[model samples]
Target: MTDNSVVYDDNIMITMRGVSDSVGLPYTVNPLELVDREALVELREGPAGSAGPDGDPAWPWQWRGDVADFSALRALNLTTADARAAWRVATENKIYYWTGLEFIAFDQAFGRTGKPGPANVLSGTAVTGVSGSAASARITGTSPGQNLELTLPRGVSGDVGDPGGPGRIQDAADVLIDDDHSLAQDYILAWDATRGKFVPAPSPRRGGPWAIAKNQFSGGTNLNEPKVLAAITIPGQPTRWRPQVTGQVRVNAANGNGYGTRCDVEVRIGGPTGELVGYGFGYDIQNWDWVLIGPRFDFPPTPTTDFGVVQPNQTITLYVIAKRVKGSASFTVDTTGAQLIVYAEPIR
Candidate 1:
């Protein structure tokens, strides 16, 4: 017995590269989800009928390891019967193809330049009854196992918020105070629930308006040289202004004051000259001595009522003026332990 089949070299090297059709494919590709896919020619080369010198009237028509291109195959002018009752068709990027009798659509995938991907079933979460500019999104589930990150829009609880006054609050502008109120330095924001806004307001009284200036007054009197503690401008006109000062005041009679040094401390209003104030006294019938004027004499001598209020809308400053009723006395205002407080009638 002789092996006679060595004459035909039918070793066709066909490589399937790129992405395979993923739709309708029992594997992964679904025929329904295909794009840029070349029409697949599922035919395998074999003897169609009687053999000729080139080889059997078969496809790929490789004779002696020499492959025939489409042109060479077309040259053969094979009839339907010659090719096993049918001829297969394929396309790279054509919308239509010629059937035996007429033109018909190729696989829809062939028309696409890029591979078609599965349609995404994107869904966004709409949280009902929540109002804010803050939004977040994440892919819950997608066909073809896709991962997508999305962001959703928010803001809008109701016409009155939880109370039904909510509106489209998309940014900081919607929550902060209105343009009508001007913010001041060291001021804080007060939440106005009614308007859904943060209104600029004064600093907390618990924190004190500010620490009083630690100033020292000496020699005869400080009537000409005064210490300005704080300056505050009224929020609006016709507002009643009240100034206050609280602190530990120390008085000392240096050398030569000789047992009869008396000092009067004056808390004045206005920068250097407005009137809304108070007073205290520091004295000793003896020479140089340290005196905490608060308990020694009537310190903060004037009652809060006597602390007077003047015109508004202007700069009202607290001025400390000290003078000696008799000899020479020196005074130190302890800023570390002192505070200045001012109040206005028309509250903002």
Candidate 2:
């Protein structure tokens, strides 16, 4: 046999021996040189066909005569093909495959079934039945095989859950006073240390009573001659108390032809011991107009002396006096407007 040369009539008979033995029959060689030795070698060594082990096509296959049904597949001698392999067929815009027994959708077989189908997808805004960003889908059916329907809820509220713990509350003793219990009128509420609770008690007095006395004096007097203006008597009391005295005397001397004239006023308070205790004095320049004199004295409690702290049955006497100083010009004290007042308030 030559390279790229056809096999002669004699060699054809030799090649038919293997085929005839395999089919269990006698074989006759064709008279014409139908196949060359090179072509035969290429057929054995070349790439496989579509249905061959290498899966390369022997020739381009179409939609099997452009038909889609099983009858078309049967007409193309592919219905009883190998069950392990599949064949691609096109129908309109979709691609399908023959899986020996039946034609399976290409997308479904390869799991490339595009987007969710219209049956599996939903549309429009979300209502009560469906809820999602897209309001895509919701399943509703009482029983299997029934048509799915949108079922909205009645907007009913769920049952309440169990209550929580007691928190700050401990027991009935924690409550202090309520509407059922209240304090009486004219009474004050005070905390009772012994009972550890609030109780009603009598109201306390705010302040004690006050005693007042006032007097005044008038007329003219010579130099160095002291004239008594007014005198106030303080009655005795059961309890010890303090006396606060305020006195004022207006004095004026007739315009003296000699230098300037001056007048003086003095105040004194006497206790039961017959001795003058508190003494205060004031001076005024003698003028035609009346001028004020005398100091206001406040005496608080002094335990050591009866003058500041008046004892029971003690008499308090307040006196006001006036005198002329420089010239012999007659000095006069205003009696009506001038005053000497005292207040005797009880001690604590």
Candidate 3:
């Protein structure tokens, strides 16, 4: 009919004569199917007052005038019985209303009689809001035309919302990828099949876990062959890596009196060696003693240029090679001098 939107038939309710979009010649209307919820709600909010036969709870009665008391009202000399029946509110919050020359009883609740709050001061003083340079803010207005302005400093912030309970997100993936697989940072967060969660993974674009070799290397291999100075195991086989190596190589003389003339070092990923890093040959390698490959780690040693692609299950290794010149040709490397800290930034 004209009342309700057409919906599926729950059952054949009490039918009436009406044409529907579905039915052609035959007219049928269900009482439940034609229920007008909006019309019902409108009827519920229709004009209501205490004067009506239906006694509405809240009645908007206007206080036409006010008098001091019932004694003062009697002193008005209304002159006739009908004139005495007019409505008048007293200072004691009592009402004087009448119907058909019959006086009505008093009810304090019919009008506002108490303070607005637990301790609200009922004053007619107007308030104004103005911005200030104070460190903290104070409100002048809460709602528009409320005459109160929420005065705040220049950088202060304010938000108006109903107070509610806190909400939460359980998964980090919800924040990073908004619960979508397309936006997941595969290199930074890897899927751990065992735990079934995203775990921090090694990526060539970010810093990986440190692979340190703190064990002392006593009387390292001869300067002729590359000595395995420090070896570190880098987990997660990232595609590419730029390893940062920190440590010093001491080329010890074979006879304790003989030192190497020069020293060199390189990094090897898996099995293959990458580029070699070297410092200039100083006096320690030739006349006086064994060569020290680097300055103290406090000073920046040669940065590793090795961007080797790591294979699966392969560990990153650091190798050192030293060249001999004057004193003794057989100078060996001693790694016990400094602590080696190595880490590889992967590019997966």
Best candidate according to TM-score: 3
Worst 10 residues of 3 by lDDT: 38-47
TM-score of 2: 0.32
Candidate 1 residue lDDT tens string, 1-348: 999977446543334434433353434342332223333323233334676567575333212222234344355555443432222233233233223343343345334378778887654445533344456656666576655555555544457535645564323674565567667665667787888777776654422244443433222323323444334343433333444454434444454443655655566655545453556666664433333322111233332433355444455545555555675444333333333333443322
lDDT by residue for model 2 over 249-269, one digit each (tens)?
566665553235666665566
Scored by lDDT, model 3 comes in at 0.47
Best by lDDT: 2
Clashes of each: 18, 3, 8
lDDT of 3 by residue, 191-221 (tens): 6677676555545354454544336443455
Descending-lDDT candidate ranking: 2, 3, 1
Q: Could you arrange the candidates by TM-score from highest to lowest? A: 3, 2, 1
Provide TM-scores for the models: 0.30, 0.32, 0.34
Off by over 4 Å in 2: 1-218, 221-223, 255-260, 271-281, 284-301, 324-330
The alpha-carbon deviation from the true structure for residue 49 of candidate 1, after best TM-score superposition, in angstroms, is: 86
